[model samples]
Target chain A: MTLKRLLSERRAAILEKWRDRVFACYPPETASFLKREADRFSNPVAHRLTEGLKGIYATLLGEAPAAEVTAQLDEVLRIWAVQDFTPSQALAFVFFLKPIIREELAGELKADAGLTAELLDLESRLDGVALLGFDVYMRRREKLSDLKVSEMKARISGLLRRVGVDPSTL
Target chain B: MSLPKPEELARVNYQPPARGWMEVKPDFRPGTYCNAASPKWLEWIDYPYPRQWSVAEEDWQLPENWKEIVLEGMEDRLARFRSLKLFFDICVRCGACADKCHFFLGTGDPKNMPVLRAELLRSVYKRYFTRIGKALGELVGARDLDEKVIKEWFFYLYQCTICRRCSLFCPYGIDMAEMTLLGREMLASIGINIDWAMASVAQCYDKGSHIGATPQAFKDMIDFLAEENERITGIKTPVSYNRKGAEILFVTPSGDYFADPGTFTLMGYLLLFTYLDLDWTFSTYAAEGGNFGWFVSHEMGKRLNAKIYHEAERLKVKWILGGECGHMWRVCNQYMPTWFGQVPSFLEVPVSPVTGTVFENARVHKMVHISEFTADLLRHNKLKLDPQRNAHIKLTFHDSCNTSRGMGIFEEPRYIIQHVLPEGHFFEMPPNTIREKTFCCGSSSGINANENMELRMQGGFPRANAVRYVHERYGVNHLGCICALDRATLPTLLQYWVPEVEVTGITELVGNALVFEGEIERTTDLRDRDLVGVGEQEGGEEEE
Candidate 1:
């Protein structure tokens, strides 16, 4: 099985389970934009769509659509942001979803050899993409949330302020 | 990768020598025996050892003299200060803390219940200290101050391990453990102190640690550790005593300097620091981080902590780091910030020169717990790990009640294990019982209190049960923890109740896996390895 074909199948599987949740909340215009973006891919758009759909879902379901979805998405992201989960959590979530997808796809793929082969290929490629996505996201989050560096600076500043010392003295 | 042959190991006949004390005769009959299975409601008269309050046993028979002495001793600044109004009025008795108590959960005994335990002190405090209580007294259903009530206060207050698991659940954030310490202090004022409490306080005063080993005994223990380190890693660890101007000061429980499991864990910290080329020193003065005074009274707690700051000042070290001892961490991590008026300003931001990650809010002047230090070091790649050293056993970490629930240090130790150990092996005991909801090792409040043994076992039962559950489900035989009291108390309790699972410090496994400059003879005896595995012979004996 080829990598491209395997990813195509996983994309299909992810879309099947999440499509309703995604489309239910997505505005018609945004849903159309997503479909257009997804259709532009010759291979499966499963991974990109799953990752991208969260933002679109938040925008549609939130109390104020114009307000930022970063806070809500941040909460959802934190559920898997711990050291035990961080870089692997997204991939793990993908892996967790795979069997369920495969079960749903079992009937369709059983009749087609080409689709079965493609599904296997899609799984491997999706694993790599999911891992890469998790790594990039975790690194960015780590920098933004470097509490020690931020806290130490704040503490030092607070101490200096109390003693009537200025940072400008340095 | 190969298991050691049984014949290759040296046999060690390790048994604790019995200390002289009164043993209750099992066959002797009092007029009637209370039903052992049923929960016994303790009466004011049934308080154990009322005679201990008297200056002499003969004097105990003279009620007038004994009462006068008790009242005279009790009416003091020490007693009044120890009996703080804040400790008395703060509790709301929501029972949110009921299940959080390890003793109450373990025993099904209502006396071990935090609400009732605090009431023992509260009830007395109300009767004497308040206007409403003095007026109403027996009419208001509050028991009047009497010798029997004082005895009950002495017995019950000491039952608390001071783990502060109850404090986490309190809506108003009342620390019941502090109240228990205050009660113990009040009791001690009247000369109604337990041997363990008195001995611990004396040891801290005279020998500079609660375990109270003399300098010679301390040297012997260090020598033993050096020999063991040589045997394991074949490196002669240069542990300098009283070295001035070192970059870091390592403060540990004196128990770790002497006891099994704790010694190995100490060796692990020493080797890790050496491997990282970090300059650190151990102070002879601040030898213990486990403040017995924290379990007794506020003033005594401050006195014990003052030694750490005093030693740090004399040595002039940049930072202090504590070893894997529970209450010690609770004292330094939680209490030291408030007690010590100001933290030192010039202390270097403790950057894990290994991992490049720094602990931000950690007590800069006084201390950092060893687990936090190791976690930071591992994060920065300071210590190289051979994960296979931990492979012989399936491992699950029991968050010491003080470390996780009390200090919010849940992530650091788990971070250390996840990175240090092999993949898929570091299973967590149920999340409900881990982290903030961790159960206490029953005997943590004070040790060798035979009267409270049943309550201790009962309190420790939930933790033992959780470990047993994980052991069965995950085939996790190794329960790695980071507290000294847990190291001393939990394994012993498990030996009687749940015999299959073993408890050890996280650093012991790290030591076993750590590679250093020289190679040492590896001994294969499981018992000699500082792994406190329970034996089957003593199973199911009711504690006490």
Candidate 2:
């Protein structure tokens, strides 16, 4: 089976385990909340994240086009951005898919004739996902910094306007 | 070694190699700590100290006999507040409060730990006040009150927002918040005061509000808010300024009169009062509800808070209706009774005119938090509210430290929000991070100044950290709090850490949902900005 077919076959189990590992970064109680509760608002962090990660999984597995997946990719990455995860910790989740795919299709890949090439292709694809995740993380960081500047400017913007510096200049 | 960068201090749980605090001196990095008071503000306040100095200096230029001044101040506080002596004397060195502080939890700095920060003062108290500490010295965990000790106290105490979250966790009921105040009072005695707080207190005393909003300036700002209300709701709500014979005196932090989000909350107050047709007046004399003096010292708190009752008497109002604020209510609830032995005859046992519900709890203080008043009105179904007006916004209420812990004002705000906004739009940050366990806005007390933005960001991390959870997971966009300080600083902090979320005072939401009887169809929101629906129509103003 191709890597795409393999991902589809074990999609539910793979996504669940990957999400469990992600939630495991929190303390046991917090991890439980991240896993057990499913309210969109009450358990918002966990609820949005599970969906975002699942969409990224499907997009990388070629279920959807790249253009269609940027928002989902951004949503998942935005979650990691605000989280306590460092750059490596955040980006590592993308690479996590590589291992999960490898283990899930281990028996089939070994039996198939051209499977070594397929495995290499899959590894390179995971590497691409990791790179994309890294870009998203950096963009999120830059957004936060930009927000700092604008908020400071906005703080005095009103007073400045009252003082008669052209509003456009601010 | 080198000083840690702000981000490194926040991310790393790694402690610098230290044998112990006694061997190590406090380090004051630029951008992470406050500069000392300017000579002008000190002279203005008649505080005896150097006119100009910097925390960056090796010599703070404290008054001569500074050590004597500090010791005498300590002794006086110890005698006056038994709570201070109890906080100073009793500590089993329990680690419960160590990790509870938002600063310590956010920054991972050991001295930011409430126990250790208090020990900076406790260590000194051990030397001079406790017989065992003086006799045993280093063995008893006591250290001398030297210049290094003073710098250490100044750095760490001011870093504390005095949220009192740590006090709740203390098994022995020791309060690091009170200890921080005690440390500040002692330091101020010797002229080692931060400029933001001292300057605000002085400004508040002299000009009727922090930032020197004089009576005319106060009137101008109110006029501006009134105009914004007129433009948004399309209803002419004429604001009364310092008018005598009004039934209620309205007091709020001057931030409302000047700042955006706070000003929006001010617009909420005007609309609510006008909607109910309540007789009220905003006094220029007691223009500010927030007490910078309370953050500074006990004496200053008393002096600053005396204005409310004095203004109430001057206006001859029935009772004071406090606007949305945090420490404003904290001082009013916890300290007002002690400040005034009994309610002045001018102020009545605050009966909410809109609901006819008497605030028995606040009768002794003659003050009512607007949330309490609003919640009671909602309970009685007094006002016509359109909760659907806020459907586009997702909301969360940050239980402000002072309001929730200091004054036990949690449910009233939640009650108010549930009345005006959809429950599905609201999300909890984390259970542990909400209600009594709520984290601070990271810049309350007097540390809301800008010089320590980096430090505030680090201290604010845990709250932001929790907020990020809800924001990413729930698509949550709005954060509401009762405190004006929270309203002012949380937006700035959120802009830095969780850029996706916006902060507002709860009343801003309340005003948005209020349906004024026979008013022109609402076209703009309280910020005087056009809203989603109204912008689709011919936008700017009604038929004159």
Candidate 3:
């Protein structure tokens, strides 16, 4: 019913679609590795395999991963190899994992009959957040909270300016 | 009279600030921003509408119901080129080319991505010409052809420098720049044109040059060169224009005719030719060697090139040697033979009158770059050199993209530098970004005139950073390049972002090093001297 719940739902839907497509493209070993990794969310090895899957997803979506991403991944794995549970800890804290979890949760909310109307309202809010996030991501990557607040501020300013009430004056 | 110090050379004091013309409403609710869910993001985002091109009102008139004519012309051209068809069909939407682009890498703008940029044109070609595209429109993710799309194509296609760096990384060897050029040609048929390109094409047709200098201007340029030739060498190099029966027809970009550093380079070409006693004459008729229309369209390209061939025929020269201009040589050396007939048999073999070493199989008629010509002269001990004249500054060569990559003229320019300024420093930018993979002047496509200054600056910043890097690392102060376009455009960038580095035509540096036959006078008051101190500590080397 909440905006976060709605985003989760939409993301889950998208992920389902993405998984199907990825399965079509990837080899059997990669597909099985991804499937097992996706289910074992707490395990560090599973987390790494999931991270690799995310990279494959980004590449498939026509977004070339930056060189920094590869270096960061390598650093995380190297540190993890020396310390048990470190890979899982890093994966749990990985910036991109939050979106995947939110999307899966939102998908679950969509399946609930009582939350349908609330889910719809949440979807509308999620839409604005997603749009702003994507636009910023195209130029730069920013945290979800930062993206949302900036979008809200920009909107408020635009409305104020249109009504001849300068937000800066306020 | 002495030239002002490099610090005193007029700086480009122009900057375009962001105007508050467009308003973005942050709160406006668009549907959920599902990049995968919504197809809109996949569709081209048309932003910053194209400015209405200000040409003559009559020029705006569609050529006697041009819509039909244009449609027919597009069909024929699209059908004629199998390469275009193969290129459009082969791209697998791989993102390998995204980071490889200097433009995309610098700006992080998705539109600059080579794959995305190619799609701007490719989408239209699919919709209009291909049958599969028409049947499965949005389902196959194709958009209908429209006026708005056409305008966006024009704006973005010109943004490409045709550097062909993306082609190197493309798995299928698909040249997006080539597609962009072809798209421009198609648009030109429909009365869509850029004034900068059209004006250049018209100038080449009327004034025997892209810059539109008259015969008198050429003579005046030569006269000025003669004076400098006397000053530098104490030898009066007899430079003449439109002189018939000369063994070779010397052609250079018109930038050399009017600009200072370019003029010095022209003098070096003249002095070297004289020292070698190779009979060469500058034709006032075809004074300009580079074709701007090559960036615009093929028809205009053919029209501009006709003048060069016509002049070559009229002068009845055995061979035509092009000066150190980038795209000009690419056009002449690579494209000219295909467009024009086989270069004349006599023109094919360039026998150096000095050494009589015949350059055999010169289909584009035994044309030598000024650097090669000068290097040949230096190899034979033809020019008197004083390396200390160059000692006032450290020098390095920036291989012009077209000359190095397009023609493989890497050694000759270096040969001239080693021979003339043996003591001068020559530093190389990282291998991938220089020589063959040289970044464009950011304004070389001829589309980045005053109107698109922001785009030019963004695209050019990476190259400026490279020059700044070499300047910082090796304490190389002077950046010598063989391309006239680089000579003209790179300086503005250096002035804006990397003001410390001075760019010169390699020939000009050679001219500076030449020991004239007269009085020895040490003059350091040249304008554009010491504008920026070499190796001023700043940001350490950072990769773009």
Q: What is the TM-score of each candidate against the true structure?
A: 0.63, 0.80, 0.65
In angstroms, give how far residue B9 of model 2 lies from its true place: 19
- How many residue pairs clash in all the candidates, one count each? 16, 4, 17
Q: Give residue B55's lDDT in candidate 2 (0 to 100).
A: 89
- Structure candidate 2, residue pairs in collision: A44-B473, A44-B474, A45-B473, B39-B51
Which has the greatest lDDT? 2
RMSD of 1: 22.7
Ranking by lDDT: 2, 3, 1
Model 3 achieves a DockQ score of 0.02
DockQ of 2: 0.10
Binned by DockQ into CAPRI classes (incorrect, acceptable, medium, high), candidate 1 is: incorrect
Q: What is the interface RMSD of each candidate, in Å?
A: 26.6, 8.9, 24.8
B1-544: candidate 1 lDDT, tens digit per residue: 5653221111111112232111111111211111111111111212223333332222323244544544444355335554346656666666777545665544323445677677766665566666887789755434556665665565456557777877778787777776777666656444455555555766777778776667665555666566656666776666766788987888888767655456667777766766777788877778777887676566667877887877777888877878898888888877775788777564665655456666677745446777877877776677777776666667888888788877788888788788767789888877667788777776776643433343444456667767767777888877888988777666555654456777778877777667665565343321243322222223434352
Q: Which residue ranges in model 2 land beyond 4 Å of their true spot?
A: A1-169, B1-15, B528-544
> Residue-wise lDDT of candidate 2 within A123-142, one digit each (tens)?
77767776777787898767
Stretches of candidate 3 exceeding 4 Å from the true structure? A1-170, B1-71, B346-348, B516-544
- lDDT, candidate 3, B165-247, per-residue tens: 77778999888767878887776665566655656666677777765667876677677666666665566678867788888
